[model samples]
Target chain A: MAVDTRKCVGCSDCVVACQTENSVPIGFCRDWVVEVTDGTYPTLELELRSERCNHCDNSPCVRCCPTGASHYDKGGIVVVTHNKCIGCGACIASCPYDARYAHPDGYVDKCTFCLHRVEKGLLPSCVATCPTKCMYFGDLNDPKSPVSIMLKNRKYKTLIPEAGTKPQLYFLI
Target chain B: MREELIVSGRMNPFIDPHLNIWHWQIPLYLFLGGLAAGILFFAALFYLRGKENEYRAAVKIAPMIVPIILIIGLFALFLDLKHKAYFWHLYTVIRLQSPMSWGAWTLMIITPLSFIWAALHIKEVFPKWDWKYQWLKDIETFFQKYKKVIAWLMAIYSVILGVYTGILFSAFNARPLWNTSILGPLFLVSGLSTGTATAILFSKNHEERKTFARIDLLLIAIELFLIVHMFMGFLASTQVQIDAANLFLGGPYTAPFWMLVVAMGLIFPAVLEALELIKFRIPVYIPAILVLFGGIMLRFILAYAGQMSRWLY
Candidate 1:
């Protein structure tokens, strides 16, 4: 739920861990990183951030899905029901984060926050394998949760807040 | 742990790549859908006014397009699907928020209604031929009895079909180029314009030909206005919206948007039609063909520009 961009080394261990853990197809990813630079050459400021399915509060993919293929599961995490997807690509274009993909298996695929592991009381693959311990995941509703405490103590920002998708991911600057 | 700004403008080690999902199938579907809707709407309008007997060629050709082009369009859409076999899932449930749902249901209804619309005029299709089957005659008689209702339904659904093409793209909120509400009317007017052009090209009667030419000119003018409004609406919204406007203003899509969709599709046709309306008598087919070409180009350009206008990396 919360990430410290200041701590991300851009090693991409999390991306590799995710691909292996979720069996993401080659040349595709469930999570990735973005490196942006601002200002002039002599005084350039660089920012390294991991990006993936925002799992937004108001997910456009779910709303635009005609067959209920994409929907919100328990814990308010967005997911896809593979059998129901007609591979119309409507959800692919509808996602504000550009997170969803038309998997070769005839359905849309994206980050589920590792729901299979989460249900068994395990951290997401990205969080679990993050060597720098920069990735944090916990229910924001629980006051004592690590993500909640991090949010309380740190200044954070979300990507593309203007679009109004209300992304669950946070970057601790 | 600690990190530093190691280098200026360093590319992200992770690549969140762009996927080219919707191909020619989508644009072709949109074009054929608009064309079919336009033909039915115009023909049904003429029939309702009791002038169906006048524009013989337009009337005869129009109803035929509804079934033929619609099947082809639906086929193109089906081919684009990765789960082509699971397409039935779209029909089993209704999601009110989905434009695709509205489109699928409307197409189902329109296909049969269009077939009946053509069947009601069986005598026109074969003027001297006698029916070999009594059941066929009974079906035609039944359609004739409800011809007025059928005409109205066809007209109404044609507009829905035309506008639905625009709503389909406009529903993609993540794509700044397509998220505006104006796209619906812009596409509808474009459909009507193309339909009128097709009518002009095929109308056997001079009066019908002139009427369509005049109407098409007016539609072209409105279409130009809407195109301008579409960009202005985007430019007025947000930074992302402004960027969307810039995509046409001077971005990669500028050449096609201006050259194909604008100059060729709208302005050139408008000039030709205006000349025809003033009795200059330029060949009707030239402008008619231009309009049709422009209509298809518009759909293609919109599809590409919309998908390119993503909100994230």
Candidate 2:
């Protein structure tokens, strides 16, 4: 995964792209562009970063879920099945990043990496919709996958490396 | 404050958030659960001490009370929380700094222990019936062999469970009423008094009584002394805490505090104890039930009314 923050605007196109594709529930955005700006007027520097479910190898949410509603499939995408969920919002409170929420109907929902489209050999909606082509997604193990090659050559970091979640999303600063 | 959230003191009509209501309800249920767990553990402790007089009643009720208390606590917590959907989150947390976190952890451990203890009591009662199901029979025998070990652990756990409720509130530094160090000891004493009182009230006739009124008399006496110490500690603590002190001492909570806590909780129970001292035959159950009611009301009033404090002068 590659995130080129430079030349990238916080337009939330990835969020719209996700909602258009999945028809995600209202108020539940799979992708978010967080803007951090400090200082006043000319002294201010604005920075933008796109965030979503990182699909960590050691995902805390899946392990903490009692009903096994929130889980990671074989392909390493974190998934939530509405039917199996008992609406306990345990996942909502468990996520330290505040990434998940209980849908108005009581089911917990979060980013899924657009696994349905990925299965059909298409990039995630975020990667596909990024006008500046700042975001990249590929297999980490291939070494030949653009993500692995770029990660090896570029100075990039994952969100919350301290948590040791082993997130797949990488950021290029 | 947002225009929509403009809270009015006099006309507000208790429209507080559901989560706040749930917080109070959770502690109430926990106090009751802790009391039940404490009484059962105390009974088991007496049984292990070769009190043949107490062992029979312990064997009969010790295991049964916990599961009932736990079941009721769980129901109240879920109902009070309103949205049943996020209820699972209580089990998913592991934050040690949060008292609610400790409660979830302790309740998890106590729940299974109570269930196993209950199963063992059943096994003890129907040893011959267990022979029909070999696996169950084997499990029963295993638990039977380990009853003493389980009883001792239950006693230790009950102490933690009883006082932890007080510690849970005291840990929250923002609430002056709960922030006092004495609250933990106060809660523990109250837990024991309520537990002993409950046991006495529910105990059978003289032949199989689980509680001796003499013991409850002593327990209530000690509990009242602890209550006095707790108030004194709060009163002498700090001027910043003065408003809350006023609330309990001679303010909004004074009437319930006096009628319920002073009269019903302490005086009536003490009168029962005095009757025992004088060799007068007074039914212990009446005072026991009243004190138990008074103790529960104490928690209810304190938990809710305590939230009204503010730093704004």
Candidate 3:
């Protein structure tokens, strides 16, 4: 996933789209918007971007999960097997991005990159519903994919790269 | 200098301010697990050293309580689990890198061993006790024949269980406060100190009490040194770790951690034990209770404060 920060207007349409499409319970979310205001006083800069599970290549959640509940599906998407999860919350603590939450029905919940929809040849609800067309989702393994081209041509950064998670989500700077 | 404000629709309760998923149950479970480790370690250590008769409190009496403590601790853990019915899943697969998996397997092995160890010595603790069935007597006799082998295995597993209680927390690198190697040794020494305290409480022999007091004092000293070393390492490392150390340095956790865990738990108890060693007429229960209190407090403060330490903020 690549988010074009310059184009985001902080409208939160993706947030609504995800909630509606995934039927996420109230007071919980699979994805959300973050508006970062940086700088001193009047010399300020704002960057709005949608954030969700990084689905890191070195995901701590998968490594730390006691059972094989949290594991990588095809295309490197992290998914939780609800029935297998004991809901000990180890994955939630291991996540640097704070992307996972305890589902009320008693399991850890997080973004699956909308694999159900993507399997049927559709974009994720959040990417499909973004009015600004700022969110881009595709296989980074594909050299001609838009995400790969964007990273090649534009400056991009990942959240908390220092943690060494190798996040799959990128923000175009 | 730069500042940032994050305005979002992200309202996940525990994740907003910080990660706060673990609660009293986890800390309590760790405390009880460590305590069980300590008791079993001492029991096996004395048995292997041929001092089992001399340290009856450690080798026999203290172990009698281990099975009970472990069950209560496991119950607390079960209560904390969100998916109670699915806990059997923990045994379905074991992820070696996952501390929780190691913990679950360790508990499974140690819990049964504790019951068997205690049952083997039930006749010694209760003079009139006997096996009601012939098969039960045969089983007891078979175990008693190889009691030394059982003691050796128990000693090894006890240390693993002790260190594992701390490793469970330190394995999570995302939480800076708990992401240190020192926690394993720190928790092990603390467990040993608490276990000695329990032995001291149960022993009626003056010489045995004095012996455990000296050992507990040494263990307490090691625990304090490890704690100071942990903070020093934290302060010398990344900003996030420094923030973690500050939780007890001057942050909101300072009072409870410093006063309760350090002063009351280790220092005061050490002083009392020192006086007792010198033939001072101090009641044994006072220092024993203090050490136990401090052990649990250390877990509580760490579990809560670690949740408050993160890289994002």
* Highest-DockQ candidate: 3
**Each prediction's whole-model lDDT (CA):** 0.85, 0.66, 0.91
lDDT of 1 by residue, B1-313 (tens): 2233322122221113343678899999999888888888888888888887787656766666668888999999999998887999999998889999989999999999988877766567778867789998888898888888988998999999999999999998888889998989988888888888778776767888888888888888899999988888888888888988898999999999999999999899889888878889688899999999999999999987776786664
**Model 3 alpha-carbon drift over 4 Å, by segment:** B1-6
Write the residue-wise lDDT of candidate 2 on B1-313 in tens digits: 1111211111111212211222456557856865765576666677678773554555555456768888788677666543476566556546554555566677788777788777766645556544566897688778878878877887877777777767765654444565577677777767777776666655665534324556656766777787677678777876536766777788888898878877888788778767765777777677778777777876777675555543211
Q: Give the CAPRI rating of model 3.
A: medium
Clashing pairs in 1: none
Residue A58 CA displacement from its true place in model 3, Å: 0.7
What digit string (tens of lDDT, one per residue) describes model 3 on residues A1-173? 99999999888888888888888889998887787777788888888878899999999999999999999998999999999999999999998889999999999998989999999999999999988899888999998988899899999999999888889999999
lDDT, candidate 1, equals: 0.85
Candidate 1: how many backbone clashes? 0
**What digit string (tens of lDDT, one per residue) describes model 2 on residues A53-161?**
7787877667556556677874788898776665544454344344565555656677788888888999988889988888878888787988888788788877655
Model 2 bad stretches (over 4 Å): A1-173, B1-20, B52-55, B123-132, B205-211
Where is the poorest 10-residue window by lDDT in model 1 chain B? B6-15
- Which residue pairs of candidate 3 clash? none
Query: Which regions in candidate 1 have their CA more than 4 angstroms from the true location?
Result: A40-42, B1-19, B128-132
Say which prediction, candidate 2 or candidate 3, comes out ahead on TM-score: 3
